[model samples]
Target chain A: MIPAPYLLYLGHSDDPLGIKTSRGLAHFVPASCVGEFRHDDCPLTVGMPRMTLAEGKAAGAQTLVLGIANPGGSMGASLVADALAAIRLGMHVAAGLHHRLRDEPELVRAAAEAGVRLFDVRDPPPSLPVGNGLPRAGRRLLTVGTDCSVGKMYAAIAIERGLRARGHAADFRATGQTGILIAGEGIAVDAVVADFISGAVEVLAPARHDDGWDVIEGQGSLFHPSFAGVSTGLLHGAQPHALVLCHEIDRPHLRGLPHARVPELAECIDANLRIARLTSPDARFVGVCLNTSRLPEGAAGRHCAEIAAQLGLPTTDPVRFGVAPIVEEIERCFASSTPITTVSA
Target chain B: MIPAPYLLYLGHSDDPLGIKTSRGLAHFVPASCVGEFRHDDCPLTVGMPRMTLAEGKAAGAQTLVLGIANPGGSMGASLVADALAAIRLGMHVAAGLHHRLRDEPELVRAAAEAGVRLFDVRDPPPSLPVGNGLPRAGRRLLTVGTDCSVGKMYAAIAIERGLRARGHAADFRATGQTGILIAGEGIAVDAVVADFISGAVEVLAPARHDDGWDVIEGQGSLFHPSFAGVSTGLLHGAQPHALVLCHEIDRPHLRGLPHARVPELAECIDANLRIARLTSPDARFVGVCLNTSRLPEGAAGRHCAEIAAQLGLPTTDPVRFGVAPIVEEIERCFASSTPITTVSA
Candidate 1:
């Protein structure tokens, strides 16, 4: 029944739950699970605008099956009304919710209407350049979507498929990315952190877009989720050098949340690199992007490669850990200390 | 013709423009034009969520119609493939591409689906919420629809009916404003500057669920046409108190186009209030929300009410102006003139 010509369900309470699709039960249900029907009415809260011929008699639906409730299991309005019934009725909707589709709003408008490309699920997801395009001045990853499906394209395709399996040259700058503007929370998390600072180290991913993604001009918390609007859209696009702080641990199917806790994901990547070095102190360096989905075959990626070898980033995935080995260990800690010009004043 | 059940045309180069009704195109374009057609893409591109489900099935439209030669254009990939055909076909979609539905991701997922309810073409139909039924807070001018109609619920109900006509209080805060954090570009230019800061002072509005008005985040320097995602969702959701720069001196019809001359809408509202006062320098205060439609009604709203009475907070509506008295005279020239010690921290 999910054959989809438009079937949006999105429920939690108002009722309408069962729909099944392989081509069996499509009874029509949802007017709160069928009781006397005729429900619709929300043209921006009735100031008017509800016409299209009363949504074709309350949706006799060529297949439009809207329903709602959930917004509590961590965000939902039936996923923003099945993403507004597939963006105002282009029709062909379907939903169970699935981890609140990131930030809901109709599954982030049905993953932007099923283009479902962004992967910066905030953190994790990044494995590193595993496949699909990118690499030619590469090293990118910008996924931003602070509100819509906050996954930023599943964390920039799991960190551009884990830096293309440790070879290098990642991609997703979404078209632009030269002197590294990177930016946050959308455009696929700053093209997956400018493809991991151009070298394709390990993880970056953050910054999804639509009309969003600011870099500097006054910082702006870098798209919070704790600076995961893809590293605050790459420290407001390009104030980058170091701020990689990915996190993801827990496996019984991605358990325990809070970024999967590794000391609370290194205190949320050292509190987003001290809030991106207090909002850009010329950015110093910092890295982390672990997530194996519940440890095992290699203990949370070898305990994040011994916690980035005691914070120096020797990690190239001896077992597994990324942000391109912590941006090559924060570019070898600013080539051996003395940097930190106070967040690029 | 612009009817319902399901109809989508959505175009660009090929032709066909505008027509997205949820409940009234007269029962499936009973007369008008009927299941229209056409496509070239550009609905806000990037890959447009898989080119809006392959151009909504090559414009045969399972139920989606989009157009965006440039109506408030910006989120490329053809408006994320018209937000993936209104989030994967929940349909009834139409987005000739206007600017002010607060970030239109298919009308923010059809007002967050679940018993659906969206209809905005300047609004005034559908029904429901007649009295003590809806309002819980205020500010709700929603018209969202990124892919098709990027008016994000008509700039969230024109910023909750221009902050309830200015007495303040407003409503339509999407989903509890759980995250209506605007900073720059879109989100309908920050829900029309949080509906002009709930009509120049007092505050609150921003709370409506069922999706549409809920999670409106957006942030800084987005892009051209209409993309600062509504001024970065109003500087990541009202971080303003002083900045109001405005531009559009003439050629303005915005989403409906007509003449359109954005110029970056005053440098994207001064780079989204210089990044919301550098993220939160006391959530800096800024002003200006002009759209006099090429200036008239008391000319630029009376030159923004004599510059908000030389920055003191005057102007009741010699024609309508209240950028919060020049953002309280630029928050009284910084430091010490404090007041918003914390709105969330």
Candidate 2:
């Protein structure tokens, strides 16, 4: 697990989407974020005070988090130098990229001399079990998406907070790097072995004895050819009693594939439900989460209202508005009794 | 690639299913099989003459194939000793178990000293692309299943042979260990990283100018939660114009999970077609392959006829009865015309 009180590294990234990890950590767990670090060429910021490696260490930062993503998830030479600096200062370095920090010989030697740890958030734990599809004791709500990066993690985190605020027991279950960092521990399901995709999720959110809600963060869309398998596995493993359909307000196409168009919300919902029912027979959609960052205030409100009316589900932007309506729907659907303890392996 | 003229290592396995690799090689590629090696306690045989490592090497065997599977895919101490013995005899050792031969220091040193290679068939090749989901050229037929181990690979191989016998150009694309051994080279899709499951399959079966067919051997069922992700990714990546549904005559529950019931034939067919359509828009099932090994001849015939009438598709046991009906259906559906080149990325 990555040590908290992080120095969020933006590197040379300028795109807002590239710095989502830092932004997520800053917005959700501000107390754990000590400061931001970036070069002069980088313009993106998560609205935190700036600091160098020495300054961040002095400010009680325990780790340097590489919060920016680039094409192919490669680590640049400049970034490697910065990570080396952090290692020299006796602070750990963590990254959620496909490239592992431990693979670099220079950084490995430096970290060895300084006795600092390296955390690869994308690496799954060893010896993950195959999914049994057995019924477990717990209420679960999974956030599925219309496409990748459509605010699935945001909705799950918000829903967990909302449920807790309403005197209900709940915890956010992370399935990606950003979510794992925010939750401090989780499996990057996408990086797991293909055979154990569902199995990793099964272990991440196992049988809970408290009958509380496990707000599971979903991954890629069921319609996304690149990662639909991951999404399908996560769905079956989660076996959610309630599902929150996450969608972007104005997606031109499926992410990174101009040749493929995004599937309709109804079709996506049907597919997800059909697949999810293999594990959780009573799985159903409880709400819709719209990533309305692209739309203006009035337009976002109108779109949310129209979609909610058309689909007969509570719809809202978890970032701009809130997930209270969705939490209320979840409560309405699964009241005092537990709904997933009928079958056991 | 594994060198030919293999000495199949049974490794004291008694169950027939445990020795599927040897059986598959003996049945599909008899020319490559020099002889079989087994311990005294082992009763299983693929009907090949028994030979020791020296005897097999004298018979011109170049590789020693560990053709038996044990629990957890582990290499026992006895098996390691045997592998080392084979390596000392200057025979390249190959295994498809989860435990890599390269990970065993004794085997590695022995192979290095003997100037031999260790082939881990389950190890996926590096640098596989993420699936683009583009409509590729040529016709393709993928074998989908109702559960794991329902004879998808056998059906695919049979169909490819049948298509060739009918003067059609077809190739059997392997996706598992046994199929890989038979076909000589393939990526075990299940062993690939979760994110690249579909991508690996895409690389395995690429665009062809000849408008031939790639009969891809399918993996786990869409209903089998343990491995449905691999199956789904394979399905999406294959993008077959025609699908063949595979099932066993009488199965109790989903493989390895007693609590999970197998899905009905109609539901399985509909789900597969719906998912396959994301890439191949006109994808449809052309036939059903039943594994009637458990049924009597008359009962198996009756079952196939009944299912064929009910589903309005050709249904036959690829092992008991040839896959001629399925290959005929494929020919009828995709006759003399290019059906998959309408869209390009």
Candidate 3:
């Protein structure tokens, strides 16, 4: 039987499995983690609803990772997972398929506590390798929506226009791609693929990635709140240098819903940042790229700018004044060797 | 025996079941209208996949609803269902859980072709009749979200603030005398009841629905794409002069993940507007709202301004833009008998 993921009971002495993954303790306490916990037939304790560990030695899984919601649990689990992954022990952490960031902190903390060094994973920018040396500069950005008709193609078109307005080589490169797996299409997803290719040839002039060009790629629906599967492929071989989030802003407020405005936004950023930090603290945030839409208006923009300001980066449009300023800010942020500080000043 | 819903073969004249609801008909059709037709169940023909009237009746009693899709041969069957729903002689059309407004045009045309009126039977909105009389001057607004944490409550608060800024008295009031139901604080759903007296006193001052005040209520979730009963309740019974949506704006250029924006906010509004027009053609639109956090500076404000302007309404703040402008716009739009245009102007 394969060993299922285990949840360490550090707080209470009634750990049903009698497993002690943590050091410096005989008395038990609930480990603070809320991702996937791997164990083998370990019945749940510490008042957690019992979860039946899957039986059998699955093909790719050697050690199971269980999720915990206790305080500081996430860090513990991250630490453990990181250490195991680093040592090539083949540890698999079961991340949340769908849940709020607020609900996942414990899971994150526990992972940290478990000697796993977590890392945020983000897609690499569009670029081409030049002469087998380094990435060459590519200015066009491509982001796709998770589901069809959710504005992936539309946003791509809009962003291309914004980039070209800045005199940069940018455009969508969609050609043959057709319908999305989710919802039927109002606009063809393939059109953008054609645009991406055409734009690359026209603007970038022989697209190459030898010097790390700034091409933003959209991971449509891969990281949705309720879905699983973190795209490690997009993370540039698991060493993401920067993490940026493109999400709906003031969603609650825009739709006239209820929420903690600044905090919720901050939490979203923090969640992404945490993932990045787990991967590598050396990696920092570039800036939030707000895809301007008719949805939440100024509220989301202002908040994004505030987040950027808090991150000690130059905000192109402090008031979310316009997109041109954002483009300029992104260019400026990427130009620096050191972490980007306030650009407005 | 119950007769299954049937699809008529527009030009064919053979009865597979050797029976017809209408005597002397070319072919026999089921009694019910509308049924689920899967993707693979397409390429249907007139003779093949024919329903047996007697077998269907033997299984149950009256009419049958057969669900199909947008395919070539399916139109013939659709016509049959349409015929049944239209006549109004103890006939009902069940367009089972219809979603996606883009699909509505074809659906409407299909229904019209078959001479039937499709009625969506989704759940009704959660409201209580608290006001003694409807306010004569201002209007009532309802804030609902596609899902919890989608920002329904926050939008309500912002609109409230906006109304106050515009020298209008707007407040939160439940339809009934109950407060929002919170789990863990009370028993499960079974033990749950609308605590109106206690809730009203707490959420609103005396929570009286007086004609002098414009009331906006907050609801948890509205089943989307399929804006059935819940949407209808808010649009019809709530008698909202206008609806407000606060959704997240996706910025893929700077931010990375796509599909982070929930289902298209515009799509949701479009669907609601279509449904609303059926009930209240005179109902006017105030403006569109969106959050800016996911965007860079300048983008959010400009986008909001653009949308509101394009939609033919005044820009909220463009600076301190929030739900306030939405409320203000709604008020302004409804102030006169004339409907408000898009913000483009």
RMSD in order of candidates: 26.4, 4.3, 28.4
Candidate 2 chain A weakest lDDT stretch, 10 residues: A336-345
Model 1 misplaced regions, further than 4 Å: A1-218, A222-231, A234-241, A244-345, B1-9, B12-345
Runs in model 3 deviating more than 4 A are: A1-345, B1-138, B144-148, B174-213, B218-232, B251-261, B277-281, B314-320, B336-345
Better of 2 and 3 by DockQ: 2
TM-score of 3: 0.25
Q: Give the share of true interchain contacts found in each model.
A: 0.00, 0.79, 0.00
* lDDT (10s digit) by residue, model 2, range A1-345: 678899999988877777889999999999999999999999888999999989999999999999876433678899999999999998999998877899999999999999999999999998787888889898899999999888999999999998888777789999988999998899999888898889888999988877689999999989999899999999989989999999997789987789989888888888898999989989999999999988999999999999999889999999889998998888788877322332231
The candidate maximizing lDDT is 2
Tell me the tens digit of each residue's lDDT in model 1 across A1-345: 222222333233332212111111122222212111123632111011222422532544333333232221233444455445444544433322213244445455565765532221223123332111111121222332212222222234344444444333344332111112122122222222111211122223333332121111111123331222223333333433344433344422111122311234444444444433322345543444443445675676577667767766443222243345543443345443212332233
lDDT comparing candidate 2 with the true structure: 0.89
lDDT (Cα, tens digit) per residue for candidate 3, span A1-345:
112333222222234222222210111122332122334434434343232222211222333332222211123444443334422433334321112222446545555565443321111123311111122233334332221122333333344455556555453432111111011111211111111211222222234443233333333222221110111112211223444444443333211112212224345445334333322345554444443443465665675567577765433321244445445654565563212233223
Candidate 1 per-residue lDDT over residues B1-345, each given as its tens digit: 233323433444422223222112322233332343335542422112233354444544433433323332233565455545454455444342323233656666654762233332211111111011112332222221212232333233334444334333334433111112111012222222111211111122234332222212221223222222233333433433333333334433333423433334444433444445422344322333443444567676676566455543332221144334432333345433333333224
Ranking by lDDT: 2, 3, 1
lDDT of 2 by residue, B14-110 (tens): 8776788888998899899999999999988888889999999999999999987643367889999999999999999999987789999999999
